[model samples]
Target chain A: MAKKSEPQKASPKSLDVSELMRDNDQPNFLNQMQEDFKKMMIDKQVLQKCIETFLDEIIDQLTLGIIFDLHRKFKTKAYCLEVKENEEEADAEQSEELPLSPVKSSPQKCVCPNCAQQVAALRFARHLAKCMGLSNNSRSSRNASRRAATNKEKGASSSSSYSANSDDDNDEDWNPRMNRKKDKSFSPKKKGTPKRSSEPDLAEAINTDTGETDEAKNLRHTRSNSSSPDSLSGSGNITPKKRDKFKKMGKGKERSSASTSLKFD
Target chain B: MSGKPENANGRVSMHLDVNNGLERVTELIETRLIESGWKDRVKLACREAITENNQNVPSVDHLIEVITPKARALVPDAVKRELLHEIEMIFSNIEKGGYTTTLDG
Candidate 1:
């Protein structure tokens, strides 16, 4: 055999060479190589196990991280969507109500006659009064007096004196017409002989009468004349003939004055 | 018996060097894991390392691929890159030696 021939050839060499040949035997070499291979495989397995554990840990972390990120993103998206929906709903409600607003507001809008500007109806009365230079208090008082006067005129004649008294009590600052009316009503009571009053008193009455226009005086005279003679006699006792005489005299005076002015011209 | 004492001694020293390097790598990894709030993961990895079958262990490249996204999620881009570089450097350093012995030394 080749192996036996090799050992016999080595046996002729030094002892060290035989020992080296024995040590280099195939079985022993193969065993050593096998042992080395096993150790290498074991080491590789150990290293692989360590890496696998580390990688598994990393994978777990990555999965958890991804899940957490998705959760946060979903939560934010949901919140944003909810907020957007609420805003949209509110906008829709406002849009639905918008059509009715103009109709409801139309009556509430008023145009100021003085300024020609649109104002709220609730404020228009105050604005108008202010535009007319009337304070709130004065306007209210004026309204009250006007109401009182209308009430008095609708009542019986016996209530005239009470009306005057009420007017005097309410209106300490009476107008010129109110003063004249009070004077005329009170004058009849003071002067028992109404027709025989002094010339100056008559002139004063005429002057006061000038406050009425000529047409108004004529209308008043015609109304008095048309009244029943019994009512006239009962109120004043002045003869109709005397009233006619006074009228003729007044016409003659006016005619004389006009003729004199014509001759002078 | 035929091997030189000096060669055996060199081999032993190289083995010790490799062990030390591995220990350093493990310590660095543990420190980073703890700092990044992966303490539970570290415990789980240790358990898995002990319990898993040898054949089923994952490769270094696969492990890196799995870890990249996780690290990216935990740290800033620059920090992630730096950590990955550091891990790669450790592996490269280890790889310079043969799989079984310190060929580089």
Candidate 2:
């Protein structure tokens, strides 16, 4: 039996060598190789999936390009214009409207609801404050009384007889509280006169009612009373007094010429 | 035949649409781009475009306006050459496969 086993197993040493070779190629080694292959497959699948996501992102961008090109080329003109407007809207940075108060120009007129008169918008608030008899009422009335007193004192101080006539004429034109009897008196005095004797009576009425002083009107009244015969004889010549006033007011040469033209007219 | 002489560009485009040839060409182009790593480059370019648009998802039209030219320029020279060669071969094959007579008719 031993001899038969020896013949079948080839020599014992040869058997030992064959068994060692079989041991080297064991199930554990094959199992590890199989596990490594499986791991490699899983890693490859994950990488492929990641690459797919990148491909999808690029494809999506390409689709956008395709759609854009198609729409730009084939869309109707109105549709294209609309798309363009929409794109402009999107590209525009979102600007929230500020919760700010409205600003108005200095020369704009606002109609006063109470008086039904057009007032400069900038002064409308103060006008309204006066109408409402606000906290500034006493101070404003005091200032107006002081102005009227100064004007009366100036009129009285003038020694010339024409000064009194000029004062009476100015008071008739400027006094807001005067009745229609005084208004009727103004026209008869200005009758057949080439002068602007009734100039801006309505504006003076408004100025006096609002307790506002018009220096220009006062200066014109003073000039009429104080005009020398030589100055008044020349039609378009500026009086020395007017030239000095213009110079002190920092007005240009054109204004002096314009004022001279006004006097002649 | 349609009263206007057919331009070379028109003829080529007509042939490209025959027998799903355009689809096959598209497949070849996709494969070439994948093989040449152009797909990855395009993805990176797309990412750059998205970032440049203030990281806001850009409108499709705007994205097209921004990326199409760049993608065209970013295509590798070798891939472009191969694609051109493949298209030429497809044209030659169509000409030789007795389809040209039908196309001319």
Candidate 3:
């Protein structure tokens, strides 16, 4: 391991440059920097070709080895079945042991490598709101302000003077017609903005008050609205005024009321 | 090719009168066939039979030791030889015609 560590050292200046690239001030600067690095790494085109050819051969050999392994697996089917069974048993054990609540708890780690932000559960809601281009909508003014602060010092390049989306100018200019198509595609002339054809499906509120079955109340007071009867402890939330509305109805009527609007019932 | 029995040309069988009047009539069909210029065809068939499945094809020694006696007991040696040759020819036909290739443009 000590012997392997001999060539591990890199110039500190390169590290400093990489850190600067990650500093968020230069967003598209990473592209130009990578191009420069590639040029420096391969001064000769012939040398680059040779390296690429060597890499391709190595990749070919690796793929051939994998294919051969798969062929052997096909020949012995029993072993593969055993491996599948083992994986299933492992999954069962993990589920039985952990039983994690699906809900987000506390500040979870963000998947983005650089940001490493402590993301609260509300962050998902905020992110969804942002994705709708709600930045200028004023409701999420705080998030928009935060984005502007981070994006303003974004690109130190002279090209930064232009609008933020100017970076996409290359694509827009490549095919001028494409820009028109993109504009048309982005702000699609939604031929028919589907009007909420029905109120319940859109609002997702099945009138639990409708599945009236006095017999069902006698059989099991647990409302068929939710599978887990422990929740929905009270019925005041649905209509606020209606009580024991579904007093007497058949299973079909019960199912219709239960699923009239799946989002909420 | 060895013995020219008197009825060799006319008849496709031969009766060998052995000791104590025990007579054995061997079918001369294969001998007649070999005489009829099918040697090259027979050799080609044997080669193809072997090539078709070298893994399953019995060696000559195994054929003579194990297979020939059984065939001889079931049928006359000469007829058995012809049948074996015919079986080999069938396998040879498959081996020769089964494979194909595409022409490059």
Scored by lDDT, the top model is 2
Candidate 3, pairs of clashing residues: A25-A154, A211-A246, A212-A246, A212-A247, A212-A248, A213-A246, A213-A247, A213-A248, A214-A247, A214-A248
Higher-DockQ candidate of 1 and 3: 1
lDDT of 3 at A215: 49
lDDT of 2 by residue, A130-223 (tens): 5434535663453345346545655677646765755664464333234335335767535323223323343344335433434554555467
True contacts kept of 3: 0.00
Across B4-81, the per-residue lDDT of candidate 1 in tens digits comes to 112222222222233355346445655565676654443344334323544444443444455445443444344344
Per-residue lDDT for B9-63 in model 2, tens only? 2223333443336556656667777788866676566555655645245565676
- Model 3, position A46, has a per-residue lDDT of 35
Q: Which regions of candidate 1 deviate over 4 angstroms? A: A1-111, A117-129, A132-136, A139-265, B1-105
Residue by residue across A147-248, what tens digits does model 1's lDDT show? Answer: 455455444444657657556533642342354464467664353332223334444455346434555655555666754322222223346575455545
Order the candidates by DockQ, highest first. Answer: 2, 1, 3
Any runs in candidate 3 off by more than 4 Å, and if so which?
A1-43, A98-265, B1-105
Give the per-residue lDDT digits (tens) of candidate 3, residues A151-261: 443434344465553453333332323433644564333311222223333233343532343344434435455633222233333353333332222333444554554
- Could you give the CAPRI-style class of model 1? incorrect
Residue A101, model 3, lDDT: 50
State in Å the error of residue B29, model 2.
1.3
